[model samples]
Target: MKLFFSYLKSHCKTLFFAGTSVVIFCGIFALDNLPLSAVGYAALLSVCVGLVLIAADFLHFRKTHFQLLRLAKKVRYGLDGLPPAQNRIEADYQTVLQELYRGMTELVTDCDCSQRETEDYYTLWAHQIKTPISAMHILLQSDENENRSDLQDCLFQIEEYVEMVLSYVRLNSDNTDLVVKQYPLDSIIRQAIHKYAPLFIRRKIALHYQPVSFTVLTDEKWLLFVIEQILSNALKYTRSGGSVEIRLESGNTLIIADTGIGIAPEDLPRIGQKGFTGYNGRQDKKSTGLGLYLCRRILSKLSHTLRIESEVGKGTTVKIGLESTRLRVE
Candidate 1:
């Protein structure tokens, strides 16, 4: 209806002129004393022809309008260009649109290149920094002193930070190195527990983890990163005497619960969000608000899910669903 009204509006001047001509011709005929019935028939025929032409034009106009709308929505994907030009004015509009499309494609290409270069530079920098970190680790290990252990802990934290940096960069890269295969689940968990063994010992935190006799299909490296990150957070918040437990439940989920100061109720929902540090993080002043965020991202890519349950001053329990789309429990 709207299109019909708009079409009529566009040709209103032509319609008006035709109607006026018909009226004037009838008056002239009556003044000359010609047959009134013949004049009436001729006028009726002209009006019917005019209506048919308008209907055809409206239908064509509607089809073209819808086609342009679909093409506009898909222009960014380069799926198709604008519909073929109709008149010279339409051709000029299409010519301008084509030039704009070319310019847009060039801009997108340039931006992609610039972004890749920046990611490569930072990724390289993250890798290069590991060398000095390794050197420092060796030097620190060679000495025996009261502060050696503490210094080593600091170095360990630095290494974790660097790993986070590398992970962050790679996570956003256009290409990711994810090797999915079936492997012993305990193997990945063991690696994370082994790395944090020193922290557990130093903090006097009890670790209760039994070997999980299961094999899961996932990217081992990325999954390991998520496990380590969760464990790191567990240790960071748990007091010296608190305990951390790792267990597999219902055969398709892994739960890591910590008897640490739990998340504030207000902050629980926002735990994995980027740069979101809740009440506890604000107190410790050491939280980067990236660990959980990275873990969630990695898990999602692995066809896994993460859910957290916590209570302030009690503890936080992180449950990771290991069921992939390929696996059916029933």
Candidate 2:
């Protein structure tokens, strides 16, 4: 059988050496019984046979080594770091190594698929949770008295965090839920303004957008989420009577500038990390640290980029660069 020959190839060298040594020893022991010429001829024959066996053993090893290498190449595809081989032309070692390789590949693939399923579940959960959140908001709106104002504020905070969680979950999905197409940039800004109309009106914050007509390719819902997060952060930190302006600058970059307390230099570097509120959020414990983190994640999927510029006590401006312009045919 092929397997038997494969096994034999590895142990051939040892077997050949042992057999030759035994034959040589027997020849030496029986030397007096035979004629001197016959004894001499027998010794030469034994040496010649040993030499042939050694050469054959090496040739067989070379053939099997090539086969094992071909198998290794197939097994190593698509893996990052692989371990070094410990044995060459080894039957049991080869068998064990192959099994280990197959197991690792399966493990990585399964983990990726499981992660995706988990995200999908969270996305479904977010939608379901929104229904109850909407009902609560409606009930709060019916009683707009000063006593209910505090409760309303707390409810609003809960709604904001839930929306952020949903955005974060869908950020890294394989299929971008973006509905990208040509749309008036002004119209998109209007929608973003409408969604956060409550915050702007409540804090007496001014929402100023430059009047401009431009078309861009993007998913409307996700793009709005990115804008809302930036605007929300601006309004939260900006003192009452401060201004938050949305401007469409050159190079397809949309800037959201807030005249609120700005980020510290040390905190700026880690602003987009998940669940990281830094010094400002620490001061205001109401911060979930998920706003900017969700913004970064969603922007990345839309093929856009987000950049930040700020100075302490001066304020912060978050820029979202729409990159679909690069894909446009001139």
Candidate 3:
């Protein structure tokens, strides 16, 4: 009954005009000498009613034109800001708008999920490739040292680049393939330091590690990557006589400090952005700018926080906080 009243209100003016015209035509026939035919009068009245109804329907449908345009704009902007609809066709302009908004939202969500999976697959593939690469490197080691020395180094560099790519991809994984369990944090740090033993020795940088044994729940592989990146940066900036300190502070944090050329004040804020090396990196030209960025990303995924303190030409210290139920009891 409410719907019927709404329709009548929309066409009331047009209906009144049609009725007035019909009454004038009927009066003209009644007053003139022409015969008043009932069938002709009924046909003329039906035509007036059809025309008014068509006009009313057009006005009702056009009311939603602006709303439909707004929904289309939402789809173009790539935001999943609306819900889905069932029937797109045979619907009013507003209903079509709802359907479009819903479809666009679903499309964006699927794309986001697919993109993450692609990154994970790429990282996994890179890691898998390293196994064969290691085997090949081992075979080359059996040859005469002088003959294979240059080739061996080249292969090693390739392996490092592959690992770097994998680390970059894994850094942003929302569903990170991390197996967190209770493990001695110090053991992992020792293992990471040992991996870069040759580089530290060749650079002639003094290494200092304090025996602070603390256990935490964390992914070992990801933590190792963070450590490696920090060590690389320290070694890159430190002079031959400088010392790199790896120690624990307050039992919940791991600190790595180096007496190296530190970060510039202006560029410090941007250090962890992807591919952003800033003043120090551009000046040195050796930094990929990926190291610290990847470290920050991985640490964030693992629910850890990293902090940096530096003074130009003096040194820098990177501290990582690992807090979990698995932390050792005092």
Candidate 4:
């Protein structure tokens, strides 16, 4: 109804002119003492015809309006839904839309190609760089050099960063490697602990681990990466003589709590965000602000949740919630 009124308003000038002409014709007939009944019939007929025409035009307008709405919904998929042009103006608008659609399609294709090329380059670089790192590890360990332990630790950190580069690349790629199944929970946690044994010893941080004998449905490799990242942070912020403990709570929540330089209360909210490093990161120049971010992302992909609670001077507790994850019983 509102649209019909607006449409009538648009042709108000024409309607006014026609009404004025009818009034003038009637006045002239009256002044000449001519019959007014015929003039009244003709004016009534014209009004009825005008009403019918306006109703038909309103129906067409409504149909086109609905068509444009549906077209807007499908615009993301394609631009083939332009309604049949009803006038020269509508036809010109459709032509402009087609041109815009063509340019947008081309732009999307180019961006996809460029993104693939960049990912490929980085993947290649990560693989090629691993070879030299391995060689360096071999050289540093051979014959038991005086600084072998320290050198190996540094090399290990370098390897970790390179692995992070690969992980970051994989996260953004279309193809990701994840094989989910029942994995011994203890074994996965132990593996992560073992990998950082040297770091633990070097930092002189005590590890208190309680084995929770069970199986969790998850991707072992990805879960291990998440655990390792947590362990790395736990060890990084903990000072000598401090302790880190891994235990199970509430049957399905795995907790890694560290007696380290805990996170500030204000920084806890944004701690896991990508490229976000709070106070500790600023103090530790080597922090890349990606470990927790990667851990969060990987755990989420495994249908698990990551939660952290920390106090500035006390400690931080990292929890992996596995109760709600998708797992089928054997």
Candidate 5:
């Protein structure tokens, strides 16, 4: 009804002109002394013709409206679903749309190709560098000299950087090699602790770790990486004779607390962000700022949560919440 009214409004002037023309013709017939009944019949016939023309126009307009609506729906779903245009205007619009889609697709393809190439190059470079790093570690281990400890430390740092590069690459890969399974939480903790045992000895930092009786379903490799990162950070900032404690609290929260130069309050919020080196990192130029970022990301992927509490001149406590019930056992 609304559409009909709108159509009538648009054709009102044309209708008025047609009616006036009919009235003028009747007046001419009347001036020529035509019969009144004949003139009235002629006027009615003219009005009937005009009504038929208007109805035909309305039908055409209604059909076009519905067709355009359907086309809009198809375009909304997908560009490829756009139907063939019936008019020159729609054809021009479709041409522009197709060109835009093609250009966007090409841009995306180029980006993907470039990203794959970069990942491949770095992955290869990281592997190639590891050969020498391994050789150095082996050579340093054979040496019984007092400086061997320093050499080993340097080798460890190199290994850490290499691993960081590999991890960074893998994190952005299309296919993740994540193998999730049930593993003893204590075993994972011990592995991380053992990796840094030499560091603890060298720094004379006291380690206080107790075995937890719970098992967690997670990707052991990724979880170990997270644990190692947390442990490394704790050990890096702690002073000699200071202690690092590892404990499992209720609700499956694993706490790693260290008597280290703690994170500043303002800097704490941004520590998990990539490339965010806070006060301690600025003070210690060797800090890469990727450790916490990687840890947070990996933990999140494993459906775990990482929370940090710290105060300057006091200590830092890192809590990792592990909920085995959240896991899909299969």
Candidate 6:
């Protein structure tokens, strides 16, 4: 009924013109002294014709209206499901849709190409740089008489930066090599500590680690990277003779507390953000600002949480909430 009324409203001007013409014709007939019954019959016949024409137009309009509604729904939900156009106006709309789809497809293709190129370049560059790094490692190892501890440290830093590059590239890749399984939490912690043991010895920082028997479901390689990054940061800021403690608390939380210069309060919140270096980093001038950011991201991927508490001039405590029961295979 609403559609019928709308159709009538749209054709009101034409209806008015038709009615006026019929009245004029009847007036002419009346002026010629036509019989009243004859004139009335002609007027009724004209109105009947007009009504039939209006009904036909309403039916056609209703069909078009329903088609438009269906087309709109298909365009919004599934463009591929849109039916073929049956009218000129619908054909024009379909042409515009095709153009838009083509443009979008081209844009997506270009973006994918650009991303692949970038990944290839970085991957190749990382591999090329490793050759010299490996050669330098061998040389540093062979030259024991030269007291090459500083060279060894620099080499380690270089390797870390290279690994960071590879990790950053892979982090955005479509296919990530993640192997998740149940592993001994203590074993992972030990591996991380062993990797940084040389740094601890060189800096004379005391280590306090307590073994905890717990199994956690995670990608061990990724978790080790996170732990190493955290440990590296703790060691970097900590003074010589200071201590770093690793212990497991209730609720399966792993706490790594360091007797280092704590982070500033205002900078604490933004530390996890990529490329964010606060007061401590600015003072040290050696921070890459990616360590904690990477740690946070990796732990989040492993369904764990990292919470930090710090006070300037005191120390920093990093809490890793490992809710093993909530783990899932991804």
Tell me the tens digit of each residue's lDDT in model 2 across 1-330. Answer: 564476567677877887788677667768657676776686788769967886676666666566556756765583222333446745466567668878997998899899888987888888898899889888888976776766866787777777777766766666655677777878878887887787788778887877767777877788887887788889889998889888888859898999999999999889899889989999998777888888787777677899999999889988889887433332
The number of clashing residue pairs in model 1 is 0
Q: Flag the better candidate by lDDT, 4 or 6.
A: 4
Tell me each candidate's TM-score: 0.87, 0.70, 0.64, 0.87, 0.78, 0.76
Alpha carbon deviation, residue 231, candidate 5 (Å): 0.6
The residue-by-residue lDDT of candidate 6 on 1-330, one tens digit each, is 898889889888998898799879988998999899998998898879878887887888888788768777756443675556768998899889888978887888899999989988998999999999999988888898566998888888888889888887777777557788888999999998988999999989999998889988898888888888888889888999999999998958889999999999999889889989999878878776887888887788778899999999888999998865555666
Considering only N, C-alpha and C atoms within 3 Å, which residue pairs clash in candidate 5? none
Candidate 4 structure quality by residue, lDDT tens digits, 1-330: 787787778788988998898889888888898767877888799889988887888888788878889989889788777778988998999899889999999999999899899999999999999999989987886747788888888899888898888888888787767787888899999999999998999889999998888888888888888898899889888889999999998988999999998999899999889889999999888787998999888887788999999988778999999753464433
Model 3 agreement with the true structure over 109-210: per-residue lDDT tens digits: 899899888996897899799888989888887877675755764675577678788766765556556787777888899988897786677668999998
lDDT of each: 0.89, 0.78, 0.78, 0.87, 0.87, 0.86
Q: Model 5: per-residue lDDT, tens digit, 1-330?
A: 998998888788987888788878978998999899998887788778877988898997777677667767765344755555769998999899888878887888899999899999999999999898888888877889889888888889788888888888888888657888889999999999889999999989999997889889899989999999899889889999999999998859999999998999999899899999998989998887998999888888889999999999889999999975565664
Query: Can you write out model 1's per-residue Cα lDDT over 273-309, one digit (the tens) per residue?
Result: 9999898888979887999999888888888999999
Task: List residue ranges in candidate 5 displaced over 4 A.
Answer: 1-78, 324-330
Q: List candidate 6 segments past 4 Å from native.
A: 1-78, 145-147, 324-327
Pick out the ten consecutive residues of candidate 4 with the lowest summed lDDT. 321-330
Error in Å for residue 207 of model 3 = 0.9
lDDT of 1 at 248: 98
* 5 versus 6: better lDDT goes to: 5
Question: What's the TM for model 6?
Answer: 0.76
Candidate RMSDs in Å, in order, are 3.3, 7.2, 9.3, 3.1, 5.6, 5.3
